[model samples]
Target: MKKFLVVNAGLAALVGSSMAEAGFSPYYAGAAIGASQNNGSEAQFCDECTGSKFTMHKKNTGAKVHKVYAGANLNPVWGVEAEYANLGDTYSLDMYRPEFGIPGGRAETARARQKTRGIGLSAKANHRITRKTSIYGKAGAFVWENKNSMDYTNLDGINEKYKSTDRGVSPTVGLGIEHEVTDRISIRAGWDRTFNTGKGDRFLELDANKNVTDLHSVKTDTDMIYVGATFNF
Candidate 1:
């Protein structure tokens, strides 16, 4: 993470110095919506993960993503951009933890959610493929923050909650295409991936009467694809 920060700072300083000497920069900003897919192999949750027996269930996978970015298009082939991206709070998972003590097989309802948001700064390189079309790639650093929460409801109408929040810095890489429909407007399609948070080692635990337990683990790394319009000034 420190390396990512150092690299970006150096690049930013270089860009600032170059633009200062040239006295001008082409600036633009845009918004996009996409699907953020949670990698299956990277995160796994089990109710009895720390016990002799384990029960596992699937969590929400593909989630809606939104991003807004502004940048200086320093030249025809290179630029620098800053972006804010969010996965909101729509993704969730539900499970049931059964207890034999209830006689009629009583169980508690369980639900959990992990929401992700980040701020990123990137250096982009564009390659013209046609008269009005180009392909581009980007590399950047993002401070990814995630909020994880869990809730439990018993048959007797009691509620309990567990929650945790953490942030990490990771590298982001992407490839995209742009088509200029007019001199000042363009259509873009892109895919990007943010590296793992490296802190998925925690779990949520809810205990009722010291007999039944519900546990859940979470991770919030992201892979996404998006389409949006860019308005250039």
Candidate 2:
């Protein structure tokens, strides 16, 4: 019985030492820089006619993004993080309308641009593949602000500028791999996507009499790939 107790105590101590060597930190901070792609569609409809509509599809509209984050590890497999991200400007679309009835076709041009930023809170789950390497998945909600602007020139040689701001919360999901370089430092690469980030709000095109003629709406999802390093305290 005494020998059995001694062996059990030895095994318990060994397990405790292994847990200590796992390098779980209570708090950490990190920064990342990456490129983002915006994908979605824009629709234009005549306010007066129910069936008159036009739709434009957008894909791979690229932008630059950067994020700073801080988090606490609750245990070996769970953590929570808060982050602020600057999602740079993206060119939404360009449209040209040609007037074929004129002696020489005159083209009317329209262009759009969008700027976005957000803050998010996430829950992270980790699986250790080895002593120094782990893979993680995160799910979160992001509150974002998007600013959209359009410049249009018509056949009458008149330029019209329309601007709108939209704010909302979006669901964010990500997967990442991390490798520990030291007890206090780790490097990671990840991919994150925010769904239906900028939705709702309609931009109205008005006629000369100030009557609403057409309504335009844009919706998009944002995807980002990033590499970063974190320091634990």
Candidate 3:
């Protein structure tokens, strides 16, 4: 019986040592921010014009957009994050009316500044390669809305107006690193890229038969750099 007790005590000591040497836990929650950019394109033409000689007009624009976001991390090397950001003016282009007898005077202009604001939720998984550093990858979807408007005057003293709102999905992939400062705090830095696919609509005012047209499809790709803190719970 004494020998059995000694064996059991040895086993318990070994177990305690192993637990002490295991270091910190695996689960964490945090936030990050990085540089961002956005690009979009749209086109509109008279839809009611049935004549073969009708003119076609188009416009394309692009610019740089920047914003920031915040999120949280979960267990099993996987976490969820929510971020909000706004992109500045990217770019703009204008196309004149085509060379047809469509009687369309000036082409559509891609000017007028634009902005973006939205929130995104994503799921991420991370692997620890060392004691103080780890690499992680994340993929998720986001819903974003955009509003664009343009105004111009025609030769016939008529005013033209165009505005649109679009909502779609944005998929993202990112790589990041985390450094632990204490048992309750850590610093994180990461870079992520996302592709947004969708289109924006437009409204045109024309006296000839109340014309309406669908604008062009727009796609955007953005890169961001982020650094933030995390609290382990």
Candidate 4:
């Protein structure tokens, strides 16, 4: 009985030491760079004119995104994070109103560009699948700002430029997998999405007397995939 007790005590100590070595610290910080796609539609309508409407569909507008985040682990399974991200730019081109009656039979064209950035706060849940591998999911809210500009040209060689800035808060969600390379360092890959990020309208046209003649509105969602490294403290 004495020998058995001694062996059990030694085994307990070994187990405790292993647990301590594999445990995560309370705080961590990381940075990630990735590609993002914005999905949405841009529409222009003239309430005062008949049959003067145009709609542009934007699908797969890709951009580069980078972000930095810091978080505290409340326990082994739950944590919270704050992040700032530069979500990048999306561009689109549309051709409207083909002038078949004209000699060249050309069409009126419009080009648009939009830029976005945001800060977010998130609650994260982690599940460990192995000694060095884990998966996580996060839900959060993001406050975003969007800058939009458009240039339109008509068959008569008249050019118009319009700009607008819109700001709003949107819901965000993400899922990821992480692997520990050492006690203090880990690497992760994930996908994140922000919904209804761009939500507002812009004036696309004005009359000779400076009255609002045409209006444009757009709504978009952004998605990103990234790989990054984190350090625990």
**True-vs-predicted CA distance for residue 16, candidate 4, Å:** 11
Name every residue pair that clashes in candidate 4: none
* Candidate 4 Cα outliers beyond 4 Å, as residue runs: 1-20, 42-57, 90-93, 96-98, 101-107, 156-159, 201-217
**lDDT digits (tens) for residues 66-183 of candidate 1:** 8998888768778998999985542355666567534446666766676778899999988878777889899999887777777768867699877777777889899999887776
Q: Stretches of candidate 2 above 4 Å error?
A: 1-20, 42-59, 89-91, 101-105, 201-217
lDDT of 3 by residue, 1-233 (tens): 99999999999887655532332343445555445554433332323433434333322223333344444543436667666655433213333343343445543322333334566778877677777667778888766665655554443445666676667777877788877677667787877666754453323334655543433324556566667787664
What's the C-alpha lDDT at position 134 in model 2? 91
lDDT against the true structure, per candidate, is 0.70, 0.74, 0.54, 0.74
User: Using TM-score as the measure, which candidate wins?
Assistant: 2
Across 153-232, the per-residue lDDT of candidate 4 in tens digits comes to 87787898777777888999999999998888899999999887766543245687645454333456778888889998
- Clashes in model 3: which pairs? 33-226, 34-225, 34-226, 35-225, 43-216, 62-90, 62-91, 63-90, 63-91, 64-90
Candidate 1, position 137, lDDT: 97
RMSD of each: 9.7, 5.6, 7.7, 6.2
TM-score quality measure for candidate 3: 0.55
- Give the clash total for candidate 2: 0
